[model samples]
Target: MTPLLDLPSNREEAWRWADLGGIAAAAALAPVAAPEAEFLDLPGAKLLFVDGVLDATRSDLGPVTLGAVDPGEHPLGRRASQGWTLRLATDAVAEPVQVVHVATGAENHLAAAIALADDAAAQVIETYVGAGWSNRLARITLGKAARLMRSVRLLQAAGFTSLREEATLGEGASLVTTVLGAGDAGTRIDGAICLAGEGGYAEFGGALLTRDAQRQECAVRVRHAAPNGQSHQLWRAVAADRSVASLAAAVEVARDAQKTDGEQSLRGLLLQRTATVNLKPELEIFADDVKCAHGATVGELDARALFYMQSRGIPKARAQALLTRAFVADAMERIGDETVRAAFVADADAWLERALQSPSRSREGLGEGSR
Candidate 1:
């Protein structure tokens, strides 16, 4: 495979903003090889990627035929970075494919690929451990009538430089993806989803939390190519300290396409002084008689609501945590699972507790007016 580090570095191009080339700064640092997966527990056929290599002993799903795992070898090369893919065999409903990525080293780079066969049904979960010290990339593809409900848990890896995912949905296929990004340093998720088949539908939901200097940026673009296709995106975020989070999403409906129903909402919560957030929702439509809408909001804790809680003797920190969770839980409900969704909410609640109980408020500007 050819090694191409010629990937673009500027954010001027829509595709290059906050790219992973920054990882080049420390790429040569001795990367600790990922240790043996001793006690990890997962519920599906697992494909494990560690230290940029596929673990044979710990990985249950065998390697894909005629495929490359390194991003540097792809046709796009470093320009678009690299991603993994798996083709689910036609009408094959293999076991749930769980992508478990555990990170323990530094200066690491890796990616994973999966494709669900036509009429396949499976669940996928991505768990990232170790400090966010590596740049991880993944790509997921779905075929006709293929259903993959997936969740990505961004463990408290503060050393990671970037995390990006690219996904495509085929004709009459469906994908529901949830992103749980609570802790990480300078993490950016970029996804481009295409609906190429009629009667196809896609849903994208995500929750992001950032504190201190940690930054999380996610951008998703969904294109509706066939008529009667639908897409909806709901994203919520919380930022504190000097942390920053931004989301820009757009859904496009091609000209002459009708019977399309789609909308996007990107909302954020600023929990402390000096926290920053950017939200941009876009909808591009060239066809009339199609339904599409978009909205975004960035604000601090609701003062009136917080005061209401404090009036009931709840400490300020506890009250803020409650409201923040409640605000994010509203979208958490859209995930459509009682057991898993509840567990996810519980995790978010725990994260919010840690976020609130910590030194979230930047001391430098807590005493003065600030955004």
Candidate 2:
């Protein structure tokens, strides 16, 4: 029998607040057969992966090619049994592409690569569903003057999910990423972006919602390797019922990367006293001409706002749900596709309903901390 892969320990900065024990337990289970495919109602071309393998019957790959990815030596890469790659030609504009991963087994690993030529533009959507452990690695590259918009949704009902994304932008290139994660089990996301050419731009916005002892962590790093690069990070997390949610974001500017503009904003809301939310924002700038700023805040819902709503005849639970939805609206707006955005919002609303219906338990003080 093959030995299990050693997962990251809590000592690691990225995994410090992750549920490593739960991840390990899920990783130990053997891979099972792929479950029947139940596709989502998403527009544009679609590629469906069932249990880490491509489902040809259900996938309309268009320009995407299968068996083209070269998974490296990373732990997730080693476990990946299948991969896919997509490339856009110069000046080409294609309809949105959606990739869905459905995990029915105990362990599943997958890899994907996306690239755009000069002046090309495209939108991509990635969705994860079903149970078990799903580990995915994605690499994205943008040529000079290219543009790409990417969105990720983690909608798994159970089991752990891990995703790592690495994106590089060229001169005058642009990349925007929006993520909505509402999985019942634990989730870990590691993202890195590099502005390799002058005038490159990258933006990331994410909203994470956890409840019922669930946990989620996201760590992202943006590096300015060239002059006149710009980047921004925005994240909102909501935790309830003893759950924990965390976001650690960092920005680094090289010594010669002058005129770099970077900003980070992180906010967390706790619904119950036992719940925890952690936000850490860091910046290391060696360029004197750069303008960089970071801010983080963690607290419970505003009692004043709740009271005001209740005073106006709104039920307490309904008022709480309304406030929570409004809190994450900014991040959710980052999705460029209106239809996709609406679908995401509907999912979030459902999660909020379920979360608010649960009885609240009171602890001593607010379980909120930020750095």
Off by over 4 Å in 2: 1-3, 28-43, 361-371
Encode model 1's per-residue lDDT on 1-371: one tens digit a residue: 11343444445444443434434432433445454443224454666666545677867763343245545433222332433455667876654555666665554566666687788876666666554356666676778888888777776454554565666777788888888887554566777778877878888878888877777777788888888888989999888788878888889898855888898989988876578787878888988889888888877776777778879999777777787888888666755545557657877887787777665353432222323
Mind sharing the TM-score for model 1? 0.83
- The true-versus-predicted C-alpha distance at residue 170 of model 2, in Å, is 0.4
* lDDT: worst 10-residue window of model 1: 362-371
Counting clashing residue pairs in each candidate, in order, gives: 16, 0
Q: In model 1, where do residues sit more than 4 Å from their true spots? A: 1-42, 62-86, 336-339, 359-371
The local distance difference test score of each candidate is 0.68, 0.84
